[model samples]
Target: MYLTVFYALSFCACWRKMYFYKLNMAVRIMTETLIRNHLSHFEVAIAGCGGLGSNAAVALARSGIGKLFMVDFDRVELSNLNRQYFFYDQIGQYKAHALADNIHRIDKSIGLRTSIVKLDETSVTQLFATVDLVIEAFDQAAEKQMLLETMLVNFPEKPLIMGNGMAGFGKFELIKQQQWDKQVYICGDFTNEISEDNPPLAPRVGIVANMQANLALDLILKMRK
Candidate 1:
């Protein structure tokens, strides 16, 4: 009788464990299916990996962008910690590689490509031609304007999303999206420039970067619909 009782209890325990394991596996598969349905088809290019670029890349990865191409010639510096994503130990490392490494830590399944080369008129168009969206995240106005124009000329059908006037603290209302022409969308305060009075800090810069990422995702979803 005691042997029969022991066998019955062991069977119940094993059955319960099997039931929960299957339940957990089912949940995981459902979650991945939902994410893939929404974000498994888009590719993105980030022009620079500074304050705006690094944060925007992270946002996109978390949002489940299928692939990313990031290019930045500069190395991580101590000053970049004020807003950028690199750690102190990552100082002197190339920004593109470091950003990609950090992003992988967040989602290893994401497709990542990094280029540690400076961009110019000749290289910009070719590098970003295949991407569904081009995010201009350079700190300087000249670079932003140059890349924006080059992209529009080369890939007139593609969308170019950028940020401008995001260098201040507070005044969140001013930081919004402005549609330029047909395929360009600029997100920022659009008035504040990086100066002594308006230094680029983390909060304001992240707000704008996230806005750009959200806008990019929104555009991609709209196209699918």
Candidate 2:
């Protein structure tokens, strides 16, 4: 009778474990579905497909952003491979198109749109008018200022996330997020502009790029909630 009782207790414990396991799985599936539903409806536009833009676009796509609109007129160069996302073979291709291909490789279901034309104030206004958020990732200060001014003056309601001052190394702690206003957010050291003396390295640029992507996700999810 002792052996019989022992077997019954063991069976009961196994059944209990199985029941809780299935319950946890069901809860996980439900939660994932809820988050996916939220993210799958939001769209973002990334202006300038350089190091920050390329890395951030990939991060956003991996995070399951529903759609992305990318614009850049520059073609990939061998020097860009130091920090940008394009492969060696993609050196001659336009940044926008190459970025789209890379993003699609991560998630084929993500909606992608690309423009090879350069972004000016007018082009910025038109391309990003319908996107839920805009990410400014230009290399030059003038282009960055132009995009920022254009978006703020024209698309006042839309959120803009930008990367700035992510050059050099050993200043990882200096990189941070700054809020210009309700609709404008900037990430990076805020002082380390790329130059002949200070080059854009992958680690710092990637840190800032991912920060922008994370901020974009947080904003979109909170807005939906």
Q: On a 0 to 1 TM-score scale, where does candidate 2 land against the true structure?
A: 0.85
Q: Kindly report which residue stretches of model 1 are placed more than 4 angstroms away from their true locations once superposed.
A: 1-35
Clash totals, every prediction: 0, 0
TM-scores for all candidates: the values are: 0.83, 0.85
- On a 0 to 1 TM-score scale, where does candidate 1 land against the true structure? 0.83
In order, candidate lDDTs are: 0.89, 0.90
| C-alpha lDDT of candidate 2 relative to the true structure | 0.90
What is candidate 2's lDDT per residue for 1-39, written digit by digit as tens?
999999999999999999988996665433656666788
Where in model 2 is the C-alpha error above 4 Å?
1-30
